[model samples]
Target: MAAAARLFRDAADPDSVKMADIAQAAGAGKGTVFRHFSDRTGLLKALVVEETRQLREQVLHGPPPLGPGAPAEERLPALLSALLDLKLNQRALMLALERAGAGSPYLNPTYDLWHSEVAGMLSGVHGDAAADYLAHALLAAVRGDLVEHLTGQGADPDELHEGLRRLCGSVLAHRADGTV
Candidate 1:
């Protein structure tokens, strides 16, 4: 997985980095790689899961503003910021994952987990009425393709982060005032 990640990170076009390339880099047999990952899509999914493992652990078990203990207002922005950073730093791998024909990201267990976490936090601010839809909307703002497009257009990372922070703040403040 580390070998695959390095290749993905280094490749100009992650989709062009084939299974054989990964196997060769890892000094493993092509058959072994294929047997383990099944295909490119599966391999890409595995890589994404591996890459996101640390963030998932931190969100689930670490300290405030990311884990369980912080107020929703704080945690929500922290989570979105972390996600945006992930999308920015892992742009190549993310774009490759989306292009891998793995089907809708909405169908992925990881997406469901993130959505549930966000919606649960949102519920604390807005009740259950708009939490689910709002969670989806907030997440859509950090979608990989959108991030890539924005960055490709020379959007500053700091501006993106600030925009996300503002978006979260607006959502929470509006809900608090019963204006959402």
Candidate 2:
């Protein structure tokens, strides 16, 4: 899988990454690759699924801000930043997953988990109703296409991170603090 991932990462076009390429890179036969993965889609999905699991584990178990211990105010921005980095870093493989018929990202366990966590956290800062909408909005902000589009148009990631920081600060602020 390492060879396949490397080839996918380096390929000019994902469609060009054949089993033979992966097999050669892995010092195995094409049959060996197919035996393990079934086909291209299987291999790609495995890569993407592994990434999702790792992200989920980190947020659920890793220390502070990203994990369980920090206040919602601190965790929310850290969560968004971490998700943004994941989307950006995994852009190519993620796009491939969509093309491989993984279907809507919204329906995936990863999305559901993130959405639930975000909404749960937001409920502490905002009320339940506002938190639901705000959580969806926050997740939307870090989506792959928008991130790609913004960065393609010269938006630096640091700028994006700061924008998220300011947005979260505003949303998570108390009602009497002029949040509305």
Candidate 3:
């Protein structure tokens, strides 16, 4: 996995990095790599899962603002910020995973988990009626493709983070103003 991560990180086009290359880099046989991962898509997913395990742990069990105890207003922004940071830092790996014939990201189990978390927090601020769709919209703002495009176009990471912060603030403020 570390070998694959390095190759993907250095890859100009991650899809172009073949399974054989990964096997060679890992000092393992192609058959061994295939046996362990099933396919390139599986390998990409495994890398993402490994990379995000720490964040998942924080969201599941850490202290306030990211974990369970914070108010929705705080937790929502923290969660989105964390996700945005992850996407920014893991841009290559994420792009690879998203384009890995894994189907619509909305249908992904990871997406569902994030959506559920976002919607749950949004419900506390905006009521259950709007939470589901609002969560989807908010998540869309951080889509891997969109992030990649923006960064490719020279959008700074700090600028993206600030934009997301404003977006979250606006959404929460709308609730305070009784607009949604």
Q: Which residue pairs come into collision in candidate 2?
A: none
lDDT of 2: 0.80
- What is the number of residue pairs that collide in model 2? 0
| Candidate 3 local lDDT, 20-69, one digit each (tens) | 99999999999999999998888887888788888888998999899998
lDDT tens digits, residue span 25-134, model 1: 99999999999988887888888788888888888999998999999889989999999999888888877877766455676667787899999998877888789999
Q: Candidates 1 and 2: which is better by TM-score?
A: 1
lDDT of each: 0.86, 0.80, 0.86
lDDT of 2 by residue, 1-180 (tens): 788778877765556777898899999999988999888777876776777777788789988888888888899999999988987787766656556665566756677788999998888667788888889999888887788779889999999999999988877875523555
- Which residue window of length 10 is worst by lDDT in model 1? 100-109
Q: lDDT for model 3, on a 0 to 1 scale?
A: 0.86
TM-score to true structure, per model: 0.92, 0.78, 0.90
lDDT: which is higher, 2 or 3? 3
Best by lDDT: 1
Model 3 lDDT-worst window of ten: 101-110
Cα miss at 48, model 3 (Å)? 1.0
Candidate closer to the true structure by TM-score (higher is better), 2 or 3: 3
> What local lDDT score does residue 172 receive in model 3, on the 0 to 100 scale?
79
